[model samples]
Target: MLQTLHRVTILGPRLSFGSRPFSVSSILRANRAVVYTQTGDPSQVLTTVTYDALPSPAPDTLNIRFLLAPINPADINVVQGVYPAKPSLTSLVEGHEVFVGGNEGLAEVVQVGTGVSGLTSGDWVVMTKAQAGTWASSRNVRPQDVLRLPRADGLTEVHGATMTVNPPTAYNMLNDFVTLEKDEWVMQNGANSAVGQAVIQIAASRGLKTLNLVRQRPDLDDLTRKLKALGATKVLTYDDLADRALTKTIVKDWTAGKGIRLGLNCVSGKDTTAMARLLGDDAYLVSYGAMSKEPLSLPTSLFIFKNLTTAGFWQSRWYKTHTREDKENLMRTLVDLVSQGKLKEPEHEILSIGAEESDEAAGQKIRDIITKMSAGQYGKKVLLRFEGAQ
Candidate 1:
């Protein structure tokens, strides 16, 4: 169970900036952050801390209210202390120190600072910094810390919240490793994942073809139809790849003997090696995740004889290495694709924490969802919406 602090209301003089009037006290609203004192099982260590109110932002800072945050697999890994990147510890809850739990979110600027420029209140933004403690009702941030969404009119909060991770990973993996030409075939496993879906749509938009593979599920027919609807050239279960003769036959027929030159892998192990066997000479296999928790073992004969290249990609590292302009360009491109209907919002379910709900209730609700997610029950994304964010 979690603890909640008593709410306090204060009326103070309003400040004026140009034609916009900003109230200092109105911005000083209560805040609740999902935090953990130590890293371990998320359901066991996670709790909510309610603070009376947040202080006004300093110069060059803006106060923001989170609209939506996502519970990504990486976030879980971070909470479990298995990930390389660790969040900075904070004393936001008065005397107690804890770490906030979220990596990606969409927020609205509620109050603009005196020193900030170009952005005003009501603007939508996404964090550029990794592990910025997004699982909170409200927080103050700097302009450089976030990227403003160029077009938010037609996009939903889900799109904005998820824009930073999966979509970019999909896009970058496709473009960075290989110089794929139109009508070229690309192979990938875990094709039903968010990144996989983005790859399908983006490939279709550019006249490229994708051979998507997923684990055999009870709803195979339904999932195949869904992926094809998103522009996937072909969808098959991992079971289909088990038969070497059948896989060879299918690959030959699809590529007309040209052979697949690029493969995207998230599920590593025997299945990935089986998928890699289909790649042509000088082909590239990019691994972004190891969801199967198995080591990627490939035959050295493929590398020696076919000149195959294996590599890894991490989007967080990309953000850290690239310039701000580069990030802005990538984001603008993704936003345009969404606006043009070339990309679609991910299928998701919202887990809302009501404004008047008790802190214990909220914490338990989140833990329940995390438990379900850990058990592989949620096939779609789970988004967090704190009603008290306003």
Candidate 2:
């Protein structure tokens, strides 16, 4: 006869099931999470905590197991207490109350509670709310807090995990601010970024042209080739913009003398001012981020003579002001774009935490990655995957 088996928690005592088969519920009790007790430098304050399995979902809730979560720059800011939005502190662990560190992720429904409709076990979903504490093995969330994907072919975990922030930011910035006819041109800096790549593909889908600008790098030629392959009309580095007259002539020729009407700026300071100079009259200049940590300074003449209008956008604000139905519609639109190949997943590397690794080791790995990210060492996005013990 086969011997009875037992399961052990990640940080707690063993749970023995003598002569009885282990149930799915019993097997899913171990969880590991990245959390912090205080806001400071992420590398210094962030640590990993393993706790016993989460309690079963309460009414109108579902238990979710995260498949992957991206460490967005905003998430780092949130951890450092620099970002405006903050996550709530929770005493999920036995001895301490801490804040979890993830803004977006893709998860699978492990179980559903009574009164929960439309979502069942094995369904894939992403949080509708910001700071849902997604950097973990498992947790319980309300049905209203998540949006379910159609499980269509080609909708990978990365797409869902990242869809909420970058893709939507690009889509909205393009649609909300200005109206561009087919073949019309849009200019944006930081075009090699995740949102920038999304802007390229989304603009291509709509027959709009994008003049993409990125910082000069060793692989400038290769990077230019990749962006062009993704439907960017042109890719040039900041160095190319140094000669103002030459750059304007080139852009003028590229746009067939129509000139660009929309400029997207994520990297502020002198480069953005140069990019703004290429815009035509009545153009809209939208600022979504300031990666350079420099103030945006545009010529007063641009506003008076060119009718340049400057504005800022935050996805979190959009979510707060919009209805649930509106959010679902936006997500569905993006998902369809992904399914149809109009949009490509951002370039990324997965940082996986093995089940056998200790909590200290996992935390150290995450801190190291954060340090690299802070130092601008990681060019591609970094995603986290925490493997649970079997």
Candidate 3:
């Protein structure tokens, strides 16, 4: 059954569905999510999809209409049962039961659940934690799981939606663990990642320097210009670092001969070796990704003589461990950066959630594209859009 209710509030004009009206289990138009109940091998599409009426807004929950969810390599790993963190079969679609798979997403608040004091309908929000199906039409979730976004005047909603993941990964790597000296240089591989781009922006904003590295591409010169425009101190291809001595010289000059105080490696093994060697005495190296499919192999000298320390970070673990106040602060900082026009991400094509139900070919096409990225180059993260959100 379809029903409409008119409420008096100026969140723009609305002929809405599923979630805006507040009533007891009043079915409104909403997106039904598809999920994989079990792991899928390379040849199998072991996933089931459901589109049903959204449930009544949950007490202490914020009913969200998802906008955009980025498809990351980590998400693929989760689907294949390779990732360590797993989202529970937490959603109820009224008649049947199954598990849903999703991690991060952007959304809009359509209604506030009972006793919810911090947010309301029409506000833009993001998943306070992971597993937000930015791929669904509507989600009724705990208020604590929602991060309310201010009306950032300068940024588009698309940029705001995409901001939560990589940007913060880059920011915390620099801000949380070490004190970056002004104009001092840090070295990192994976310089073209969305997080890498954010690192360039945040590092430049703070007057710290970066030696950015990436594999050579056909448009090497153009990519270099783009990174430089975002304040990359230097951009180099892996070909230039075939010799470790050359790598050291390039890094030392970038750091004004103070030697690099830190090395950031997302690729593993020898690619890690190039960065690890550049750290000055007592400097640190941190790894958060493994693009090269190799483990981080370090020599004994760098650890003892150079006094380099190594560690790793995952945003999910960090969120769970931090006090509520700290989580809010990091979010507020990222939002403020967007508001000031200092942080810029690519504009995304919308993938409304309703598209999932009527179009099997379309959904399959998206899933295929998401599964094929490690072999090619992409300019920005592919954000799969969910429709009818908020």
Candidate 4:
């Protein structure tokens, strides 16, 4: 019974593909979507529009209509021709055609293959394929590429849509690194970020302490208080981190019985080097971002004395090559956490995509929204929505 929030929702029984007896007008028609026709200059090329009919039902297909999608940092990078993975370039819609624009969405099955019984048309599911078109009305997809989402029970579509990228990124980083003993310390920067917040909660929930490092903001006290509320052991600023004795403080704060086991680096400039020096011997360091846009320079002593292990994580590529069982488990746990009010993304605004925006207007719309998020002022998630679907 997942329901749309603050909008008129149309919910019905799953439709049959073959020998379907439903009347034409009674069925939901023409989904609105945002898409692009060319690469480079996304604002000038991509557009949003609506189609009057659904794709022909296939026996091995799961036809899904999206409820909500997110404009992630990576989505902007891909649109700006910077990401390594590219989305598909085909669109089956009639006049004023458009290709889908987002990498993730929360969708409901409107129709399933006769060969597919594990997931029915009315069930909510996530795309199992790495590049499934999610920024659209309804898409016909192969059955295996669809992950029959476990019982959402109490999770909202907002949580379902965004809970994937950041939470999983945080969880995998915490899991794949060196194992930690109770009361042991783990150091990381970007303490205010969504992923960083998740890291704090998950690590806290697992009996590990976090030495969180954040840049000084106008409201630094509030940020520090928030992180501490999320179970941060100590919050330090970049200026505080510049002190050579800070490493000694971390060592002293941890139970010497159980030393620091790992360091997670996301803000890779001076912050990374500072975090590196703070690690003890046999420490594992993992990075998943380049927010500082600087090379991760480290001193040779880190390798010689500390014996640190450093690695990088790219969620899309990692999940693409890994098992779905892990994904399902992580997603299920994440939803449970979100439902229990222990995890969340900052909700910014919901976008109602227009039905008649020109291609240029549509592209500009996405570009404007992406640029706004990149500015780093808004502490909320930007959600893209269909005007009709909601």
Error of 4 at 379 (Å): 2.6
Stretches of candidate 4 exceeding 4 Å from the true structure = 1-30, 95-99, 254-258, 354-364
Winner by TM-score between candidate 4 and candidate 3: 3
Model 1 lDDT, full chain set: 0.86
* Tens-digit per-residue lDDT, 1-390, candidate 3: 433332221122111123333332332243445454455541243232435556668777767777667767777777677788776765454443444556777777887878999788888887767765444556778888877777766766667677667787888999876788898887889988877888888898888888898999899999999899888989988777788887777677666679677777788778777667767887878888898889899899988798888989877878788877787788788878877777876534454444324334434655666556544545556776654322
Better of 1 and 3 by TM-score: 1
Residue 104 of candidate 1: its Cα lDDT?
Answer: 96
Candidate 3 local accuracy as lDDT?
0.69
In the range 1-390, model 2's lDDT, one tens digit per residue, is 332223222221111122334444433444788887778889888877666677788989889999999999889999989999899887766655678889999999998999999888999998878898988888889898898876776889999999899999999999999888999998999999999999999999999999999988888989999999999999888888999999989989999899688999999999999889999999999999999999999999999999889999998899888998888889889988988999988899999997766566778999999999988899899999987631
- lDDT tens digits, residue span 24-44, model 1: 433234477888877888888
Q: Estimate each model's TM-score.
A: 0.92, 0.91, 0.87, 0.85
lDDT score, residue 67, model 4? 79
Which pairs clash in the backbone of model 4?
109-121
- Report the poorest 10 consecutive residues by lDDT, candidate 3: 8-17
Per model, state how many residue pairs clash: 0, 1, 11, 1
Q: Over 4 Å off in model 2, which ranges?
A: 1-29
Model 2: lDDT of residue 241:
91
Report the Cα RMSD per candidate.
7.1, 5.1, 7.4, 7.9
Report lDDT (CA) for all predictions: 0.86, 0.86, 0.69, 0.70
* C-alpha-based local distance difference test score of model 4: 0.70
Worst 10 residues of 1 by lDDT: 9-18
